[model samples]
Target: MTDPLSALEAAVQALPDDRTLRVRYAELLADAGRHGEAIEQASVVLREAPEDEAAKAVVRRAALAAAEPPGSTPAAAPPDDRHEDIDWSELEASIANPTEPPFVERVVAEHDEELVAEAGETAEDADPVAELRRETVRLADVGGLEVVKRRIDESFLQPMAHPEIAAAFGKKLRGGLLLYGPPGCGKTFLARAIAGELGAHFISVTLSDVLDRFIGESEKNIHRVFRTAREHAPAVLFFDEMDAIGAKRSGNTFSSFRNVVNQILVEMDGVDSQNDGVYVLAATNHPWEVDAALKRPGRFDRMVLVRPPDDDAREAILRVHLRRRPIEGIDLGDLVRRTKGFSGADLEHLVTTAAEKAMTESIRTGSVRPMRMDDMRAALKEVKPSIGPWVQTARNVAEYSNGSGEYDDMVEWLREEKQL
Candidate 1:
């Protein structure tokens, strides 16, 4: 047989710059265990057409093929109706290109309607957590929420790192975790960081994403969310502000929301531990608003509270927010003490407003200078905590404590500051 490297070189030389031909050549090279050459060819194609869907599809296929055990055959092609592995841009081009061949044209015609409709719906109702997860930033990028971070590492990250240990004990590795706290307390940031830690594809679903005007479409969308997660196993499925769809059904409430919640419960319960390598993580400010059924043992079994920052956390948050800026005579420790009730988000806004004020002063005086202590102090006076209402609501839900005994430090701080 001819060497795969020689075959690839000949193919590339014959159809240089042709994205499709290059992709096919790369795949064949990968199958023949010439990974370096295949990667180089794929890289060249990607550089030329950064948004080339066909090229990306080829790269994914080739990488999977190259990773297979020696003598093992490549996996079968995914079903035609499945959009999970479809090259979205290639599908679009096929639909738009008038001169495409008959078979290609027929496939496009058959799938385009459903695909386009689904895409349109998804675009219209994009989940905020899903959007956040796409960025996939390291844990260091997020400021504050250290306690929550440790809990996440202990719960999700540790299990992911040692899946065999978890599996050997007959524990279910796939399930959901609930992060409940005030908004902007870094719940979404932790979710993204978890995805980064696990190296998993993250898909965010929301109440708006699944809810629809059509009678049965809402349930169908819920099914699609889990189905997509299963297709992309070892994936993180995040639901932000879960209260919207996860609210417990009350006697006087509308039946539509109830049905949607029921559908979600059923789908979540049906996820098999072995087959579906999915991790569902949800964030909500109002844990009280979540349906009782959803919070039960089998569904979102683990609930981690991401509360407002403590003194040390606040100081850390301040330092991170001020890292890029030029500041003078600012005592972060004192600032942390003063901002007793401030959330991580509140501190960020405080820093931003302070910088703006300093810039305005500099422009007025015609002198470019770093922010002064007065600028930050003035901003602190104006930027009040946004979590007061949520705090009271949380206190009203169940009790002021879950008896974890870890929040004594925060409680003591609140007492010292006379904010409890």
Candidate 2:
């Protein structure tokens, strides 16, 4: 049998000094899983054009392909090695240094639906060679937000599980969801839970992961994320703090951001794209800032309001936080009533504060003491629901700025809570 690769190799040798030809050859080798040869070809290009960002990318990608064992998504999404190709030093001074808030403040190991105070490594530290499947965080683990969980089951999970039935009713298997609510309200956790429900891989995209200081790279980064999800089919690609990346493009001085938004729109539902098993989920504290075009029909089409957990959820959140702790005779009912309107994070903080009180008492008595109702009340006096301020802002938006009634869910919830 004639060897096509050998012919290509001969072509590379014939024009060994042609960087463009060698680059094409490298790409073909990498795609064919001939990553070792691909790496060698890319190295040759880098030797000639050391500053070539494209060549550097070939090297990074080829090395990544070579490291993969057989067929499995790599544990950590590779860094934007394309960033290595461009020199951002000159542009750093001109680019206004917008302060980026932390993506994930901390991690805790799951202990029977409870977020035990156990610390763990981030995604970057996960095993690259190991199978990518890890335990999915189901809705049960979520500290409350029963309404949000039901919506996900009805709107998202149902569609995912019964694709044929959905298609018969004119629903496409692929789509995007935008979960918007106040900070620390378990939006990110809900997205993970949704992924878990479907038994799909979840990729949480961040502004830092997509936006680049160099030109055009932001768009490429977005493409790379989606491509990764498609390769690992039946996957959920989530974007946290999405408003920052998908902001309204109008009147934006930076065309680069506009370009990134445009890229996202195209990727979500391009005519030539096949996103069948790739579900898109995005979380944002500020959905109002997201581009109107993104919410039109195909991209981020449906928006879900993730309000603070109700009393039941508060108790659940409290139980999860106080489970392993030394807590005795704590009245959950009274605490839930007092902690009304608190988000899940607020509830966790409430428990933590109460524990701190117990520790202080122990420090004086030289003996550990179980948390008590008094400690809970003392913490409640100091720490109020953080959702109140955010809810106030949301109220105005829901009542006044809801031109299309998209914020109806949030508005209804507000009215029911008497906060409207």
Candidate 3:
């Protein structure tokens, strides 16, 4: 058709109540410079489905485009949405611009409006674990970390997945384990993997997901989170960025903060409360900041240190990012060798930066060109591993906090890696 937008507009007129088709129509309208109409169409969906984060994104972009100069380019939409790929930008970056405000957050959409009408699962809610979308993230999906996977299988995953064996072996089926590592080292990703491994619903709570201002609200949130998991037996409730909520209370004297940590302890105690099938998973970039009480037994007792990915894992990560994009036969081995210290997140950015350069070339020549090795080589120069400072901070913690041997795993790792 000569005018796809016009044809789509007519189709929308025919099926005005078709929200799905309207969504498609709105995308075309935004592309056709009709931001106002696009905004209206997207708002209709939002009113009907408030939890649709992508619909919210469409509205935000339409509003931004309407306010900007005519013919100005809109920010790039997040990549790899059609598949089960990671868009750190959408999960953590903004669509209006990667650097801009109101970042697109990942909210697991509800399949049936009346069946379970809630934003996300909480520790308090009866079915809190049922709220988050459950994906099949196998351990194989994790690029590297054979050792970490084995450790988790023994200490965390196998126990939860096989309760009969756990009970027979005098092991506790329901308990918490902590995943501590540098940022973007795939703690959240591993949590999802555990959920997939167990074939259970997953509820992941971040600092942004749970903190409250008024007195007792945060504690209430914590109880609700655990209760939700308990209600949905065989569920995984992951607390991300745990340091923010469970920071050490010794040097710092914030009564409210201490209360939150105490509440976590109470909820994790399966003796008073029957927590048979619920699995508690938590992750932190700054383990030292986490309250020592949280590290005790029956709580987040077992700690798995998620170090930087090995060469194979890094190569696997690079392949996933490059899979959907237009690219020539780039050398994955050479890329892996050269980018020795690159984290998964860094590799994602490296591929994105490379793709952006190829896109710029396409725009310049009016013809699409596949990404080349040179584009990647240039991007490699721009992106560096962002893990040095985090590891250094962890080293300091190991140095000062070894009296209790709580950080012995970290100390041993630093020693082996010669990072001490």
How does candidate 2 fare on TM-score? 0.68
Better structure of 1 and 3 per lDDT? 3
lDDT for each candidate structure: 0.69, 0.74, 0.75
Candidate 2 per-residue C-alpha lDDT over 1-420 given as tens digits, one digit per residue, 9 for 90 to 100 = 867677778898898888888888877777776665675676566544545665555555655544467687643324665445544433322222212211112233344123222325333222212123533688888766778888878877887799789888987678789999988888888888888988898887887687643334567678778877887888888888988888888744444567778888888888767798889999998888898999888788888988888878888888889999987898888888887778888888888898999999899999998999999889889888787677888888987899998888988888898888
Q: Residue 111: error of model 1 in Å?
A: 8.6
How do all models score by TM-score? 0.63, 0.68, 0.68
Give residue 121's lDDT in candidate 2 (0 to 100): 37
Best candidate according to lDDT: 3
Worst 10 residues of 3 by lDDT: 96-105
CA lDDT, candidate 2, residue 210: 73
- In the range 1-420, model 1's lDDT, one tens digit per residue, is 997667767877987967788887876766666654565576567545545655555545554555468789777535446647656545433322122112111123434456557667533232212232343686666666666678778876787668799889877667678887778778877887787777777887766676643334456667677767776777888888898768777731333456668778888885443325788889988766788788777678777877787777788888988999989999887898889888888999999999999999889999989987899889988999999887665544434544654334345434554656
